[model samples]
Target: MHTFGSRRDIDGLRALAVIPVVLFHFGFSTFSGGFVGVDVFFVISGFLITGILFREINAQRFSFVDFWARRARRIIPALSVVLVAALALGWLLLTAKDFSELGRAVRYQALFISNILFMRQDGYFEPASDLKPLLHTWSLAVEEQYYIFFPLLMMLLMRHVRHWRWLLFAMLLVSFGLNIAYLERKPDLVFFSLPTRAWELLCGAMLAVLPASKQAVKPWLYQVAGVVGLVAVLVAVFTFDENTVFPGWAALLPVLGASALIWSGAQGSTWVAQVLGTRALVWIGLLSYSLYLWHWPVYVYANAISIDGIQHWEAAGWMLLALGLAWSSWRFVELPFREKRVLAGRKPVLVGGLLAMFALAVTGAVVRSADGFPQRLTGKALEYAQARDWRAGQMKCMLVTSDKNLDKACLVGANQGEPATQLFWGDSHAAALLPAIENNAARQGRPVWLYSMSACPPILSDEPRQRCKDFNQRTMEQIRRLQIKDVVLASNWSLYVYGREDGDRKVLLNPRDNAAEAEARMAAALKARVAAIRATGAQVWLFKEVPLQRKGTISRLTSLARVGRSAEGLGRPLQEHLARQGFLSALFASMSAADPGVHVIDPTPLMCAGQVCSIEVNGHSLYRDEDHLSDIGSARLSPLFAPVLLGTSDN
Candidate 1:
């Protein structure tokens, strides 16, 4: 049953997956598709594991104890070393909070449920993209979950059904259908869930049941199909990115490519298989287990320590170190633990030992994560957590606060489809000024409409953007047709200043001249905007450049924790972490140059001092993650908007 021709093309495909995944993580510009390597791995895992199960079941030699023991020999020894070493490294390099986070991830990694857990917690928009030590482990957890349930299901199918192949096929169809449907509607769920990923493994299971007799195939056809399949998987590895919805139809490229290569029957003589099964690829595949384990955490810790982004060459070095360590383990620990012929019954005993180690991991995660886990308490840290925007339902506000939520009642008020006492027009930059608007409107006792969208500046659509274009077009048409007054012109005007601006950035908006001309054009646009509204008997006030933040304060703060810095007595965490926020400094400098009189209200003084920006106010956080001003920060400065709106300063 195990004598089917070896497929070298599939190993070629594995090489394809690993290289791109490594490169993309290392910061290469192209090949966002490199992430699809994880999908390719999934397909390969399904095929191999299923082949083992089918061959054993067909020979009537399948045993749960034996199968699990084999998995222990294959996966556990190197994994234990990585986990134990990563835990120690985490404590050394990670700050208190970061260490605690690592502890929890280690715990989950032990339990094999980390993918679902991580998904239920953070999201893709988080600033710490490459900084997570256990980020790649999510894929490992997904594979382990399949390993846990799949073999049992196969065993049950073989025992219960006369037509077991039909049963496997039915299960495959169901799992695949669920995968496609879930990815489209609930992507985050699809990314983590066990059921959604089961089909990829089942595809391999299907291949195992197929006839392996050489009489069933032609050599040329096998070669051609194998090449196409391998190439398709490689193309996917080089082409996909984080934005690509995965495990749905998009995942079929890697999954089917793997299946075709297996079915293509590349014998030992086949160059693709020879290369795949070569000393290097299989050696990496052997270490792939270890390489996968060690690479991500070290990379994450490195990102946490460095203010500059994690570099690709740095990842390469770490990968080499991981490879070296994996080789040592393969020689010293793996062989002794698995080769019972040499080590006697020690291999089986080692299996129990590794299982016990996993149990210990579960225990540690549980202990550390508990509410009263001993020795981890700091009252001040608790206070800081409480003040974070999390409890106030502001998670949506930070992650994707863009103007997409116009349907929210807060966006539109007494003034819709017609004139009212006031109209609030602004971009997300203007949205920051909302607490100010709310207060100003209350003091004035005027009816008001809050029209704001995230990232979209309140400007006439000279051109279309994904969000700003439709929002601006609809708003301008509404205000004009409704003859609304009290229009406030504001935005992160730093993005596309009015005039022709020549800078390092070629502005995506209408082309402008030099930097000074850009400001003038922006001023002209503001003036024209005010004039257009005034033509309908309206008043306009422009909120000048809101103080831009330098770095993602929280992530950097976590980084600081990764170091040995006391979060205490740090003045303006943003200032402390500013290197990460140079993008904002550039924008703020551009906007400061404009000084546009669509009422240049400077809230900079409220958040900044001389050259520094603070992240704490009255013992509360002033910024949420990085760019967003916190409720405390926003509220503290809300009253500052009073003078501008009441005509006490500029209306």
Candidate 2:
């Protein structure tokens, strides 16, 4: 019904937004903050879509059906192709469990709620997210959710509210405030939810609806604005990293920067605009949508199949493949649907899009219900696929933060009704040792009480979580009350002291503490805890943490099996494992020497040999994930605890 001329600079801006995202996802260090490209895309979408809505509404030619049909035509065609292709690829490459997850992701994406699905699954910056081929679709989902609602809001406001601009501004402010307030408390929710992300889009909407300038603006002002805008975006892309608190105050840099560029280029071109309007950039921008869609899956699948991680050269090759696919997808899939050459009418396009989505949803459901077609794999591949799950009843025994009651602890081994003589206590790592402990205790005719909690160490100190403190306190009281003769302390000690590879500070002993300070604090807390346990006349067996594998390494075991590739030499170096555990190993040694009642059980000697700390034993994986031990792996450690279990120790 109405039209505004296309801006080549805006198209080029899309290239600017997408290239960094591709680089970042493919592990380029220079573009660590390339994720801000999504923010740029959001602003551009907001400005263009709002401008069209404003024009059509003003001309009294706006129709909700027409608006939705246009959006479906633009988005659904390429997305459908990607989804189907991803499923086909998944069938060939994924394990049953992973294929099920991919099916679940497809189900959510078809409904335009993959953002919510991912929010509940993993943080955007987490290593696990790198394995997800459709992870980038969350941004698309956010934009689609906006498209579904914003036009109706605009119509309602135009019909009833005279001061519509002020209302929209107030909404933006409210959304931004929510984003900042919950950034620390609920980062995932703030990152994925439409409410918190609305302000970024609203910035562009506000720019579109701003009153036209009555006076001819001086060219100097536009030049200054354009340069500053481009600089702000580039600075964010180069300087920011995963550690940055994002989509809060930090988001203003990209959101306002895109808005300023749009405003500056509204009437005439500046040098910055000319650069953006270059033919190469314009072409990349035209292919941006398909490029974004294609790149992540390419990266994910490539990484999945590699024995080691993808090197820079391998990444470069994969990116070339992505680019070629993006170009083909644009030419064959996006253009025909978008130009209405395939589904030529509004009703046909809308109906066809709906049917496609429905088909995908049903297909995903069937895949999920069938458990990702486990029949697709046999032999070692099937075995590897099944090994990803934790031991049966492991989840039931592991207490999380909310489970504060000590009576809820799982009792294993013999004589369950009588007072327990031994206890297994620590975090999820300790929980993983349940198979070994239970089997040993059963043979010894000793009942062991398990007081393991997720992320909660057995040690007591000034923990940020009061629940952990209380759990530890209750555990101590239980030792005294039960007259427990033995206490095994185990946890992911390195995680509390050094944090995760993804820069997750929340699980650290103190997020603000330096590495040395964290190590010192943990040592002091653990020493004090051992003394407290010794006072109860119980022997403390300090179980050293299992060696951690590199992120995404374990998944490669099954992935390799699927492709008939050997997983030999697929383990971390022993030196790296020893180095990570150096501090803890020395601390455990000192604690044991100080008091014979406190004994150290180091798993390294059994789990490692020669030069490598192996992730598998005789074709069976030792780890269920990067760091946690699998059930079969845990059983291999049964001998280490035999002295305590069988009452053979002199202590």
**Candidate closest to the true structure, highest TM-score:** 2
Q: Can you write out model 1's per-residue Cα lDDT over 2-80, one digit (the tens) per residue?
A: 4344544555556666766766666676767777777777877877788888878878998877777777666666677
Task: Put down candidate 2 lDDT per residue, 571-640, tens digits, no spaces.
Answer: 8899999998999999999988888888999899988878888888789998888888999889899999
TM-score of each: 0.65, 0.88
Backbone clash total for model 1 is 21
Model 2 worst lDDT window (10 residues):
1-10
How many angstroms is residue 363 displaced in model 1 relative to the true structure, after the best TM-score fit?
Answer: 5.4
